[model samples]
Target: MKLIKLDAIDSTNDFLKGLSVTQELENFTVVSAENQTKGRGQMGAVWNTEASKNLIMSVFVKDFVLNPNGIYQLNIATALAIIQVLKTFNIKDLSIKWPNDIMSANFKLGGILIENTFKSGGRISSVIGIGLNVNQTNFDNLPKASSMAVVADTVFDKEKILVLIVERLKANLALINTNSQGLWNEYLSILFKKGVPMPFKVKEKSFMGIITSVSAAGKLVVSLEDNSFVEFEVKEVQMLY
Candidate 1:
């Protein structure tokens, strides 16, 4: 569980990738930076953040034989780990969006990105990156973004927050190893749009459905307006805005 803290980096995930190639860092090694110059999200979207105002960290783990279906469990565990840490601040209304975003009400609070390295045979390592908006007070340019300060109605100490997050993450990882189904159940309990009708778009067709469940493979299942159920991969459906 070696932790490396930096003042700035291009991207924590990228830093960890480079580090893994050069040296054999221990499993659970963490690389964190105060700011990321070229942060990235799923599908190469830029992860926007104000310098020194959020948490930008990546966790490196090795030698886990992660089944493709269990990938969703990993993401759920990571999001729950961060939520557990934020709970210490008594932050309420925290919830997880399917596949990987954390939110409160309608505002974005954080997100997780899990990248895997595979040899010809199987998976070799996983790099889990997290970005959480913490002390920033202004989001004038980013309407969907909100910070811990804004939601919690107070300021927070970044170092203490990081420490708690690491501890919680360790706990979540242990649970994942021991009882993944249990962890997945807990994740489903907090899933956003679980049982309510919501507008959804698939293949550019707008329709209404109630989110029924998320499969172990991270596919979302929806009960359509006609009471028929369908499963779609993450890219197949979008929550209509």
Candidate 2:
């Protein structure tokens, strides 16, 4: 894997996208920044992290041959890879909040944002942007945020953690090539609030529902109070605390 370490950048994903347009990039190439000035999150939310205090990086997956119809498989693979890496550190209560937000207990530890470049036929490449709270101890107003250091009661080498995650991602990609079914099953097993009735807000309406499973297209499948199942794409509904 080729790794590019930047001192600072607007966004690692943007940098990787720029690189892709300017020159050819190898598969599994990684770009990490000590400071990401314009770090982003799912649905255009800002990923706020103190400079050099968290893992702000993007991985380029080039020429991956997986069918675009099962793009959620990529989401499953990425989430599981991060979870596996955190498990090595003995982090407890790890769960993937719908789609791919990494949570420990009730607090969020990290998140995954994947952007795919597609040809007319199928997906060509992808840039996976991940932001994990590492050494950042204070969330200030963001009550749900927590870091690996705070959760583990010890400091960690950010670079070492990033490397481990990348390695696991490569391994998971290999597994995807061989066992997509296994990866999908494992992802569902670790889903947050699965089988538990939880409050959700659908636009202006609020209701309780249980997360049954995610669709192949990455929609959240929820079994509601009326015994009917509804599928919601990202941001269509909010998982309420």
Per-candidate TM vs. native?
0.94, 0.97
* Candidate 2 residue runs with Cα over 4 Å from true position: 120-123
RMSD of each: 1.6, 1.1
In model 1, the runs with Cα more than 4 Å from the true position are 120-123
For candidate 2, write residues 72-170 as lDDT tens digits: 777888899999999999998999998899999999999989998986766578999999998999888989999898999988899988899999888
Report the number of the highest-lDDT candidate: 2
Give every collision pair in model 1.
none
Clashing pairs in 2: none
Best candidate, TM-score-wise?
2
- Poorest stretch of ten by lDDT in candidate 2: 62-71
Give lDDT tens digits, candidate 1, residues 122-146: 6667899999999988889789889
Model 2: what TM-score?
Answer: 0.97
Give the local distance difference test score of model 1. Answer: 0.84
